[model samples]
Target: MSVESKKTREACCSKLKLFLASMALVFFAKAFGGAYMKSSITQIERRFDIPSSLIGVIDGSFEMGNLLVIAFVSYFGAKLHRPRLIAIGCVIMATGSYLIALPHFLQGPYKYETSVSHSISVNSSESALPCHSNHSLSEDETPDVETRTACEKAAGSSLWIYVFLGNMLRGIGETPIMPLGVSYLDDFSREENTPFYLACIHTVGILGPMFGFMLGSYLAKIYVDIGSVDLDGVTINYKDSRWVGAWWLGFIVTGTIIMLSSIPFWFLPKSLPKQGEEESQSKSTELATVAEQGNFLPEENQDHEEKEKPVTFQELAKDFVPSLRRLFKNTIFTLMILTYLVSVNGFIGMITFKPKFLEQVYGQSASKAIFLIGILNLPAVALGIITGGFVLKRFKLGVIGAARVAFAASVGSLCLLSIQVFISCDNAEVAGLTVSYQGDTQVSYNQQTLLSQCNMGCSCSMKHWDPVCAYNGMTYASPCLAGCQTSTGTGREMVFHNCTCVGEMKSPAMNMSAVLGQCPRKTDCDRIFKIYMALSVTGSFISACGGTPGYIVMLRSIQPDLKALALGMQTLIVRTLGGIPPPIYFGALIDRTCLKWGTKQCGGRGACRLYDANAFRMTFMGLITGLYLLSNMLWGNLYLKIVKRQKKLALRNQAKENGLEGESRANGHASINIDTNKDDTDKESTI
Candidate 1:
């Protein structure tokens, strides 16, 4: 090659690499924001005093946004400048992220619902009854209407709507990245190099969740009211279910990163020459002749034909229905779509509730659970994806081979998930809820169960949930339920003395005092958590190994012309049905397992305070396992179909070759007879 040509080739390669890097950055930034949002779900629920089901709706809003714009963008976006479109999406995503944090600024400092009073003076002569003082009515005075109205005005629940809308906006912005970015890469890159590039993108993208979850874990340790309130006065620890982190901060950080990601795309050209265009174009004449003769044409020729056609609004509208019809006609593609739908459903549900599951079942702190997932599980997935791609490339596996690998991974993960059912820690022993004060099991959920013979004369309200622990390791609903008449100290350090509930433990010599906060579990629970993490990491790695191969199978099975649409349709179907419903239903079902529900400041129900561990484990794991098993069955059917089709095509080709050979032999004999007749005529004329 000449010097100019070599330099031009080098420039093209450089541009391609730049585009790949930009795409990877976009992937990372978006995944970071998304994973951060998932990590903060519990915090947001607690901060807003919303139920789990409501939180699920908020989580599902992202999919709602995607449903609104994905089909249009996926179909029509190909005609536009894709890089610029992605840049516009990043701007929108940044706006959404900022909007999600808007409520934190607009609302007052987070005041968590607590039965303990902050207004009481430590030096007061009279004992301060935390729960009853708010209702202390004098004989000559009626309740003040003005005071009641003022209190009602202070509690606002409407702020969460901003979060929901913002999440939806995020979904809308994220719509183009996967479909547009992946298609762009595949179009420009060499055929053999596509898998490696995809793996690189995914591996980097996986790190986003890891860092995002890690950020969540770090943030969860800080109190939501950290700057505004005195930490010394806060009674709850990070382990408490009521703890709310500074979840808003993460949104701000992620938004900034996404905004910065948009700048590079703005500078990039609308289109770049294909990586090997020179060499490929050299054969274009021959390829065009083959296409004209009605022979099999390469994907490049089809792409060229598509590019030659003008993309107008009318043309797109006319083609939409036929395109969709043509896509669904393939049985293998249809089955593959169904399998993906099932798999995504399980994945969405599991990820949405995994942190909550760890907290409830394994007795882990929210921060710790999020941290573990980010640090351990996500990295395992990243490694598995890279390894999976390597396996595919190294072994040169085809469709059937890829399918089998995916099937085996699913089966292995399913088995690992089944093991978790028996690995749970014992339920927290709360007085009146899970057990009686006298150490007997109780199965009832009614508020009346909170009242027992141990503190029958204490006159405690069932609405108050300020729990206090006794010397015998039992936790009561409140100090009043513990039969404590007086308290020493204040805030978290406060101790309730003369607790009659302690006497029920049959130890009269022990100190009859109950402290604030629930008791921690035994050391065995910690060991159980370690083991669970190990198994969880292993299972995650195994499941992720199928990621690249599974994607390849889907890509290879569809026609090149329909690749973009197939991906978009898959996203449309999977995200709309799978993403939107899983979180809502999972949250609703998990809500049923809640043993205790918190009360909102405005007198409505709030987030769950405690859960029935065994029930939670069964519900969460069972749902995931069932979905995986169904997907496995679909994979089996798809593999069988692929094999049958390959065999049929081989037979058809053999028959065509035999027919061509017989026809060629007959033509040769006919030519010989004509030559012999011509020679006889020449001899007769000469004579």
Candidate 2:
């Protein structure tokens, strides 16, 4: 009713609806940045000649950044202006995204190791002698003395460290958003409306990864140096292991989006009157908003005249450790955190390498693999989250009910996941890798030196991985390794003839011609790949359906005052243990399955050119299965704890009610007896 209150209310957009909309946009931008990074991970590995394990470390760097400041930020920022802190976090995140792209500019153009010669690889009617003493790589100059020196400098510089630092910055920037942002939304919103609000925000946030992956897929089709380099001379397609797409471009776009999303938060007020209240000044505006969706009724705040003081450092430090101890003391809460940690460990690893697995095991192209995930898997997850939120709101589920739903989803999804472990496709039949040059699958990774006597006469380099598919349906490591006497055409059109290795040096009459790129997988494998995707999407949806309910269980289990701290702790603990390590360990295990590794131009071992497909499948899927099973066990324990606590509370309340009734009855009886005694005394006096 006062002028000051009126002015604050008239600030054009101090409504919870506006806040929700802003949060949704921020969520979308953040998820987009994150998912885009995941999608581009493969390209990054190829570009830097980095192995999968090291890439895992780089991915974990984001979590590392969170470990630095999440706890302090969440607890302290709660009493301060949450919206403004979130704005600052977004800016830091944008800076990190920009930093991730820094290494790309600092390095030279990507030059994959290849033995094909652009100058002399034209079509030739007469086949050159396969046994010529000049051999394979002597024709083309891979890098001149100067370029070679630059490559050495690039390789030695560890440019990937920039990505690590940038990703870490992103992690730090992201630390506050979920804990502070979600808690802020929850604080001012009605309790009943909380689940729907969360669902809507998460549903919108899910769009970010969908778009991010789509962007990555689109960018994967274009060359990394599209404008700078001549594509005519490039021999590999996007399907080639050597291919590096424009991974840096998406970061630039995502960074800008995140920066722009920060703008609205600065304009937003720190606190709003809770969602259900009715304010006279904004009565008309609130009514219109309600049908603009059963709109706003802002509660009049008696404390509007009093500005809330900002939380100080001393107050936070004093309360933090004590509050944390109180939270973990809750059996259900601790169990829930542990359960989430285990599940997320599996998720981070699965999401990070799923694209690479598709490329390796099922023979999907990088671009196609990425595109399928964006189009299929992510949307299913978003739907599942939305469904879970809807289910909670519809049923008005309590802690026990919510836990049951989450547990059921976990079990159902686990069953589906078990099916995928057996649905894998056979490994690509590549000579000197998964098989011998003479069409035998009896090969070990260590047997690369003695792969075939057929290519030995050609003096081929095992380091070069320019694959050529022979007409007989066998993949030779390279033209030189395939004993191709001559080449035809250029770029993707180039071919080699008189490939003695493809012929096995047996039948001179047979035509042993080969073309660029590895052979496509058999039709049977393609059919099985489709089956795998269906199961993958189904499992993702089923598992994700539990997301909102599980989150609700955690939210309801803790004390109201510790909500922000609890959320922050969850991020800190889960990210540190679950997020940071899974990628590293999974990548290390995946690296062990490499049957053929590429070589850096300056000479160290490079990113894997080929993997033992069965090993990759077992390692990736097996890790996820084990983690999920552990989480299921924990989830079951959490449910039992919740039920036990609820029962104890019910019994305690009943006992207190009974005791109060008995005391009242006893008091009534004593009053009657006193009246009787007084009456008898009166009678005696009268007599």
Candidate 3:
């Protein structure tokens, strides 16, 4: 009813709201940045012609920076005006995105300049004619070639530089945003809403990468045919199909700016004491009152003078060291971090090498391989998000379980897919390219029956008919064993006027040996994306569902409010230990295999192909299986220990508290009797 009480309530609510908003921002930015950058690395490699190995270094640079600044950034952020720190973080992130867009325009100039240098050297050699030795192309040709070459090189360089610069700037921007945002959130939420709000932020955060992937895929598939044209009296070279992720980049630029603009909101302080804290303080006050009095007050008539103790800045400051310490002491915390590091390493490493793997093994184009990987990853991530969430909720599991299960599934799928890839690769090596002994002819079959189904009343038919069937009765590359009627002379069906049957029929053409020899392949891509997504989905499920159990166990072992801090500490340790030089280990393997197999750039004796296929499968499968088994044993043991400890601690504390209360009551009653006796003696003397 009092103004002060009302004011306090409103302030508490405001602080709580602000903290949630801040947390959501951080989660969104982190998840968004993570997903966006995962694909961006490949994009940069394509635009810059950078090797996959170096791409890892580039991507890792941001995390490396994070490791260096996390401690200081979080400390300063908590000490400063919460909103201002968050706003600064947003500005930094936005600037990064803007910078990312700049390289696109620069690439043109770089390309033009580089092309000019190459042209000049070639021109100098060509210009020295026999009759007119050392003579330039009549001033006219020289200027034209030089001008054209300069423009080409400049354009090329600019394109690549833009991609590199964009990624670098984005990395810089992301560094402060994550930690500061979370600290800002710490000011707002009570313990009860923390997990729910965190979940909301995570769910919303998924939108960023999902949108990015969708946008990127849409951009990738668009085909533009810039028919031949002359510009300023110069003929430009024809380009068949080139991906200009211009539109998608524009969207990214806009989103980055918008997110940056919202940073100012974090400046408003929104913090409140949690429900649990209030309850504890109330309990203490009640106990003090009961101890001072001779008898305990009735439940309804109990004193209501307890004041809510607000958390002070000084108290918040002490959180950093203790939070870190708890994580260090907890065994489960260490395990989760190790699991995550290994999972990320395997996922990222394999994907990075995928293009090379496909190119070498399947003889696919580099761009095509990269594009396929990107497309496949989308579904994998999407499905992982959805399914992982479901699993977490359904099984009452946490992030750890989802992660373990997903990783295990991914490893298994990778093993099978690897086997298929290997078989196909071997077939290519042993059978070699099938030389055409005779002209290949075409064959056509019943459209309705061959297709086997119709969609929405739309009839399915082959656009181009292949008439040729192998003498062994197989038709088409996919292999159909349908009976066919051949025209009398050509052994062709009479479905059409025997165009090839009237004369010498072309010898039946088929790659039967190669066809049978090839393996049925499975890929962790979008078309096959569901499979990979299952892994991510399962992993995320563990993160979400497994989070609660992990928290509960840790809570019993340590303290409450320390879970997030525990997670941070775990991150530092896990990265230090489990993340120990996987790249180095894998790099050594690649080099050793490259030398042993004698594999050269893109080709050689299939060493990269052989090693990559076998290594990726084995590593993922072995680690996943091992991680799951170890996690089960570890979690199981910890769970039992926690239960036993909890029971023992609970019973002991209850008995001790009861004994103390009984002694306090007896002493209070004696004092009350003494006071009564003194009062009666004084009254009698006055009488």
Candidate 4:
């Protein structure tokens, strides 16, 4: 090859590598942002003073954004400069990230519902009086709440809209990266190297979530309004449902990374020579051919017909419906999407609320729950993906083989998940919610039950959930409800004495003093939590092991021309129907388990502070298991169809081979007769 041609090929090779790197970086950025949003779901719910169901809608907004643009982008983007489009998408994603964090700057300090005023604390002599006084702690805040302007209240309630819009923008920005980038790589890359490139990118994507959850765990330990709010007055810790973390900070960090990921795309060309194309050619004649085509770009590689004429939106639009019809007509593709639809419903719902589940069911702090998922569960997922790739490569799995592996993983994971339903911690022994003031276990919540004669004189406000733990290993809704008249200490460390409720517990030897915050769960509950984590990690790993083969099935099932559009359609359908609805419905059902809800300043029920553990576990795990069961059944049907189709194909090929063999045998006999006749003619001439 000429020096110039060699240089061109070398430069093209380097640029392709750059594209692969950029793709991985973008994948990591988007995954980080998406996972971070899930990690901070509870924090957002509390910060916005919204229920799980409403927050769910906000979480689903990202998918909604993708639904608006994915089909169009996936179909038309392939015809344009794909790298530039991806760059533009990363920019949009960054904007959304910044927008999600905007609410924190716009809003005032977060004010949690508290019965004890930080200003006076327990320093006042009158506050230090015995339980006989009918002083209400809520009385001090009534005038402020009543005097609040309508506009101010509306402004605070509507701040969550910013978060929703921001998340939607993130969804829209993420639409093109997967479909366009993957198809683009598969277009220019050597066929054998494509899977390896994709595996690398996906590995980065999984790692992104790991880092995101770790970032969330670290940030959750910090106060939400860190620079603005004083720590002295903040009584709630990360374990408290009312505690809002610095959820906004991680968005800014991930956004900046996404923005940086876009920079290399602008420098990359629209296309490159297929990898190893030049290296495979070696003749002097081929070198001449390479020299002649040195300036040629591979933009026309994806379609020869497109080389004759440029593809346009109008042309593509006419074919979109027909393309979709072709895609759905393929039974394997259709069933695969259906199966994925059900599975995604379970997966999205499970991941979205998992942190909350760990907190409410296991009595773990938000930080600790997020930390565990990042450190343990996500690593298992990463390892599973690696192992799955190894299995596929090792076994040389075809479509049917891949299907079997996915089905087995699905079944194994489902079994593990079902066990989680039965393995649960008991509901906390909180007075009035799970247990009565007299220490009897009952799922009762009433004024009479909460207002027993012990603390009837204190006239505690039932509106707020200011929990205090008693000495008998039980918790009260609040200190006043515990019938603790006098208190010592300050802020979160404050202690209450002469608690009639603690005296009335089943344990006669228990003291009558109460301290701040809810009581810890029993020692056995801690052991149960560890077991739950172990099971959960195993399930995640088993399910993730099918990731690579499942993706291969997606690629192999579709026609070459339709791959990009089919992927876009799959994402649109799965994300819209699967991603959008799961969280909303799961949130709505989980809302039913709420024991005590946070009270807003405007007299509305805010986010839930406590939930019935057994109900939460059942509702969360039941929905996931049901969805996964449906997925496995569909997969079984899909697997059967694949086997039958392969059998029919094998029979047809075998018949064709037999016919060809018979034709060859007849021709061989005719050739032998001709040769024998020629030898006979030679012998006659010699005689």
Task: Name the best candidate (by lDDT).
Answer: 2
Q: Write the per-residue lDDT of candidate 1 for residues 648-669, one digit (tens) a residue.
A: 4455456556675356446652
Give the worst 10-residue stretch by lDDT in candidate 4. 291-300
Q: Per-residue lDDT for 317-357 in model 3, tens only? A: 67667555433444444544555555545544454454445
Deviation from truth (RMSD, Å), model 2? 9.7
Pick out the ten consecutive residues of candidate 3 with the lowest summed lDDT.
233-242
**Which stretches of model 3 miss by more than 4 angstroms?**
1-11, 109-172, 175-188, 222-258, 273-327, 330-336, 347-567, 573-648, 651-687
Candidate 4 global TM-score: 0.89
Better of 2 and 4 by lDDT: 2
Better of 3 and 4 by TM-score: 4
lDDT of 2 by residue, 191-233 (tens): 7788889999999999999999999999998999889987877
Error of 2 at 200 (Å): 0.6
lDDT of 4 by residue, 456-489 (tens): 7776777778888887888898877888867776
